[model samples]
Target: MTNHNYASRVQNHNSSIIADLLVQSSDPQNISFAGGYPDASLFPSADLADAFQHAVADNTPAVFQYTDAKGPQELRELVAARHAKHMGYPATADDIIMTQGGQQAIDLLASLFLDAGDGLAIEGPTYLGAISIFENYAPKYYEIPIETDGINLAILEQQLQANRGADRIKLLYLVPDFQNPTGITISVAKRQRLAELAETYDFYIIEDAPYRELRYRGEHLPTLQSFDTHHRVIYVSSFSKILAPSLRIGYICASPTILTAVAGLKSAADIQSPNMTLDALTYYLNHYDIDAHIANMIPYYAKKRQTMIDALHKYMPSEVTFTEPEGGFFLWITAPASLDLNAFMYDVLIPKARIVYIPSQAQYIHGDVANSARLNFSAVAIEKIEPGIRLLAETFTNYLTNHPAE
Candidate 1:
């Protein structure tokens, strides 16, 4: 038998750190703050069931047949209309292409735009999945420092100015609303500044807005797409958070010029996304009030977020600080410099605390930030939140006291 080597991209890629940790500590009772999955209770199962039944009953042969490479026309129109209304952009069905999921959309975008060593500007502590996605393309990532409000404008400007490459940056990717891992939303002023910079610098912006509607507090900030008069922003969103993750339906809204190219690329990549799911999702949107469904989830997740915050306050040490996210599934926690989170997970938390969290270093492109971790409150039950956080706190306290100051 001959052994074959993996592709260079595959060989270079690190296996998903999150998946590795989850598999290693597969305890049903484990209080996991690892994955950014939505609460199962919030899934619109009844609506989806109804939609599926309706699609099956109303099924023409076309329902099961292959769809256009750009996806079902009706669903694309609906998505474009929704994007137009939400982002105050002039979008048409022609400017939208459906993909498997938000991640695939990211991959498709990377495939469409990035060549090896192309400059890609991203937030300092960004989404790990995005890091993985871009790594395969081998882009030189420029990390823009993140502040409480958004990405640091000065640093972004500096990086843009510093990149002397002839290919120029393909695009700057941003999760402007309730960003994953950190839950930081870019402010309106920053959005304007970013748009201006994009226009001046003549680079495209890929605005990944997967968590826009998950807001539990504060007013919604306008998306970067909203301010893009120069046709510089390619906005991507999914039904995963709002409807169902299994549906695997996501759409990209861009200028017709760019979107046309993306559609061709998408067709070559996967031909088309699943038609049955698109039909069902369209039926669900038409029959059900999505706003009400989302409204119901807000309080459910808000309560869970509060539970985790309260637990941390009651049990965590004074030096251990965390962000109070207004929306989204994650909270970024920073422990004292002495605490090695990987060691805490391996030697202490996993064994003693019976909890798991995504080490924050996974979020960084350069792999430097280590004294932090991400906590997901959405997946765990309200009852589990307090105990899990308490256990985590106890583990941290023990680690600090046992390994006191040098």
Candidate 2:
């Protein structure tokens, strides 16, 4: 018998709650509302195929060779320019470090800044993937309750005040624009207040904003990075949602000091993101009008969002509460307190309903949100949403009726 011991970090870490369930339940016929994946139908396959061919044919030897550790210059410039124009940020190529994807960007940021036992603040119900990333470093996780507008400022200030010490906290991780799981956009006032807090506390802010450009309704608010005069914000985003996830190209904008350090860390980690993908994306961006491409996606997602919302209202019990997201792919659902969502999922929703959802327990840093679940309407087709929600509602009703608690 061979025996081996795993590292403490690896042993202590829980497997990705949402991803584990997704893999287990994934079926071609299954109506999945679990993953944060974008709609595959929206991928520009023909255009990307053409761009890939052109990139290899035109660049030849260069396309096959390893490029700069900072990524191809053209792709970086394109990302900088696009963000500057669309996001109202003063981003330049020098301030941007191209990453493999948004996940890598998060990992690199965590690796560069955090040490074990340090404290990092996050919204109560936040992006689970980010929480997973930070867990590897074993940071002391603190949660600030989330409101409809954004992170509850009062709770945030209280947490910060309580945690103030000479050791100094590491970072405040936020997804201000169309946050994952919650799908709540932080208002402009909150963005300003968050910037002020970062400035006052002298801590860095990691704004993971993969879904900022996927707005289906309402005016776009300025990013927290926009108000960051002290260069305290690290704004990370990806072309994954807008273009294609397979390309694995994303970038981070921060102070030259921080970006330089992150670039070095990235170089040691992955050398550089594939130049072929970057070149292809750059070709696509240069040749095509990206704004028009994104504009087309808005209506597609808008209809899907409406479909899910309408179905939920029609089929769900009136006691169930959910948020109407202005942008992004998720609807945060809070079921009646009488229901144990985790038990309901395993006993009823997954088995009887034959549907998959990210139970809200996966979203919390401390694993305490027991009665909530997150529904993603982006990847699933609009036609299937009605029936899927019906299944979900039926499961909820069944659970409530069967497991009545006084």
Candidate 3:
């Protein structure tokens, strides 16, 4: 018999493939390209150690005590200053609210705006993690297809027009810079248009840009939030990609009203992120140069990204196509529509090659795209990239050849 005490909100939610695959990624035998893990070797261990020591020494009992739900004012100021420098706009500490990570920021926004049956629009193939979070809200999902530049604006506007007043979409979420899974960046024109559309349609935009600072090539584009004139954009980012995931440092920059409300939600949800961690981060920012550290990481990650792309070009079947992302931890692969990559991975690739990747089935809200996969490069050892890709290609080729499309 079903448990009656459970909330109905969780009734439709299923276990995410991402969680299971993350466990698979940890196995010593598997060449896992599943988790969006940063290169462990690059972590600023010594600096962080010193920073932690300084935090303890300087703040003492305060670092150990409860702090503001929006995180330390010092850290927020640092985050605001950094945002101003990188995003080409001035931001104050009041505009920033800290969270456990980008994930929490996303969750907070979803909670603040969405109710059951409320209209929510997201990229067709968005970050899988966000998909899982949105599941709890049970919002009416409108998935817009993505293009080389970004989401199809025409279809989005049509959807917006069709759904007006009570039916208008309440929230639109997107990863505008080197988007998760696909690693596609939205064009500046699209970014401007998105801001304009949000204002015109009277909806909010969540620019989930955790990977914004990781660009390895091309000219850096302005953030979607920068173009936002009506305070429609809630900009979210994290130190996970650039610094360390364990820091659990992420922030939201938005208008005063949104920031205040979200801060309340954040406070009620977890009280606040760990004060010690926030203080340490403050010390690190004060003593060290995060931008320079990020700069140092660029070439390393760039090489890793290029290595994976090169291997794909050299070994992947002619029919298989993959993205060449300028930056970001993962790249996307698209196979023939007839091929179900999830089945292929379990039935053949895993047993035969000991390889694992994030299949596309779980990445979308609809879970209908089955021929694609997301392969991560940042976590895997540099030496393993080519061989793993080659093996992955060989396995896929063998399977496709033996089981030709029916």
Model 1, residue pairs in steric clash: none
lDDT of 3: 0.91
Q: Give the alpha carbon lDDT tens digit for every residue of 60-105 in model 1.
A: 7788898788887888888888877777887889888888889889
Candidates sorted by TM-score, descending order?
A: 3, 2, 1
Q: Mark the 10 consecutive residues where model 2 has the least summed lDDT.
A: 1-10
lDDT leader: 3
Give the alpha carbon lDDT tens digit for every residue of 32-93 in model 3: 99889899988998999999999999998898998889888888999999999998657899
- Which candidate comes out best when scored by TM-score? 3
Model 2 lDDT on a 0 to 1 scale: 0.85
TM-score, cand. 3: 0.98
Off by over 4 Å in 3: 1-4, 14-16
Angstrom error of the Cα, residue 379, model 1: value is 0.2
Order of candidates by lDDT, top first? 3, 2, 1
- Candidate lDDT values, in order: 0.84, 0.85, 0.91
Kindly report the root-mean-square deviation of model 3 from the true structure over all alpha carbons. 1.3
Task: Report backbone clashes per prediction.
Answer: 0, 0, 0
Question: Cα-based RMSD of the predictions, in order?
Answer: 2.0, 1.9, 1.3
TM-score of each: 0.96, 0.96, 0.98
